[model samples]
Target: MKKGLRGLYYSRNEMDEMVAPLKFALVGKFSSGTPSIARIRARFAFWSSKDFSPSAESLVVPVWVSLLNLPVAFFHRKSIHNIACLLGSPLKIDEPTTDYTRPSFARVCVEVNHLDPLVNDIWLGDDDGDITQKVMYKNLPLYCPTCSHYGHVERNCLLKAPKNKNTPDVDSTSQEDLRIILDKKKSKLVEQPS
Candidate 1:
């Protein structure tokens, strides 16, 4: 359920600690309508024992790959081996042979990044040893089967009330004040062409 939030607080507390420094940068003063910062949190849910586990093993995950075009026996063992060596050790290959009747794609399993979770784009080489065909990779993140959302599990969904519900409301006025301040600052900015 949605509810209104408080605008201002005169008391010296956590809010003051966070917002006190930005008084001049914001507006002359913060009032009851001033908005507060907000953050979105996510949770994980487990389905079956066979599902991927974050702590069980390596960080690698399976990624579906497909050749764009200009296919010249790139799915062969030698080519696959060369491609694997260029990238890294392939956890698994979809099929030893390429299905010309289909779209010509391959599924490879690689470790998930432990530091950066984002998967970067890939460039594959053609039979002429020149980088030509761009392979596409696709992977799904861990999500709850109940709500089917990217983050958070069914047990702790926002739709259902929890044991402790104290989501603080952000003041809408502060956001407007911030926008005004930003506009003023932007107006003062002078552009210089090089």
Candidate 2:
């Protein structure tokens, strides 16, 4: 499940301010696993506000905590907590809490599995968070390796020029390579004598 667009002109620190006490998964996390109530429990964890940096509209949970609760966190398909306890994994039955007092917001994350065969698992929702927004139905686009972008699904990228290359960034790129690209385009036009 995707939320609405989160980042337009938010800086690292600014993002923190808006989504303070909110946690999110970094781009490189692996939350795609089989959809089991138990495994879903493991993905859920507490996210500290200090380390709450996350991708646009994507929530981030702590790896350590999410990993621990894998077995009995999610109750989507079935909530057989008693059965789980019989096997040894204990279940936590508490009200969802995302208090501002604590630095970390604890959540139970489940592997976002896709019902359709084509699309990847969009994050549906977490057991310990409020993801009941209307916009969540319009899932956020999947991550892309080629353009290094999110928001739009990779297959949907149709722009001629790469968008990220044009964004003003913190690190200054050397002009040598950029100049070469500009020159290459110029020479291609000259070939037509235009």
Candidate 3:
């Protein structure tokens, strides 16, 4: 009954495509024609830093050593470089090193995704190698192809009324009026001169 409910949730095409090969083979042990069952797990990975030199090769790859214990090893192929023992709940790789030179300071750029996206200032390392101070939020403007203006994006622009180009531009007309008035004033001043 549990197998029938699980099968109903996923389409036959999805079950065939997504089910692992090992799980599919295991299902054959059960009664005639039941969909394969496999428990899914997510593995998250992120780099410590991204400023490695192009000349230096074999970037450090950290892999979990055991599920029972919190430990990882930086390995390249079959060769292991360093074994990191995670003591804290949230593991942190302090000053991840490469095969090449180690930098005294590592500059990192952080971005906040919100209503207005921003790129933070360059983070400087302290004596203790800890980051300090809140970085200023620099607004990144969106470019609209339709109006060719920067600031608010395309969708917001469409809601506003379209500008009429058929009528002469206000700036040009104002400049022309000013020129004519100046010419008339100059003519009157010249005629009054002795």
lDDT of 3 at 11: 38
lDDT of 2 by residue, 1-194 (tens): 24541111223454344354245523232345568987665645332346554553332211111212222222211322222222223334222322222222223222232222222112223333322211111232464444545555556765534557554442465677667767888898989853
- lDDT of candidate 1 over 93-116, digit per residue (tens): 554233323334544544344333
Cα lDDT for residue 165, candidate 2: 59
RMSD each, Å: 29.3, 18.8, 22.4
Ten consecutive residues with minimal summed lDDT in candidate 3?
70-79
- Indicate which candidate wins on TM-score: 1
Winner by TM-score between candidate 3 and candidate 1: 1
How accurate locally, in lDDT, is each candidate? 0.42, 0.34, 0.32
Tell me the spans in candidate 2 whose CA falls farther than 4 Å from its real position: 1-112, 115-136, 143-174
Candidate with top lDDT is 1
Question: Considering lDDT, which of the candidate structures 1 and 3 is the better prediction for this target?
Answer: 1
Arranged by lDDT with the best first, the candidates are 1, 2, 3
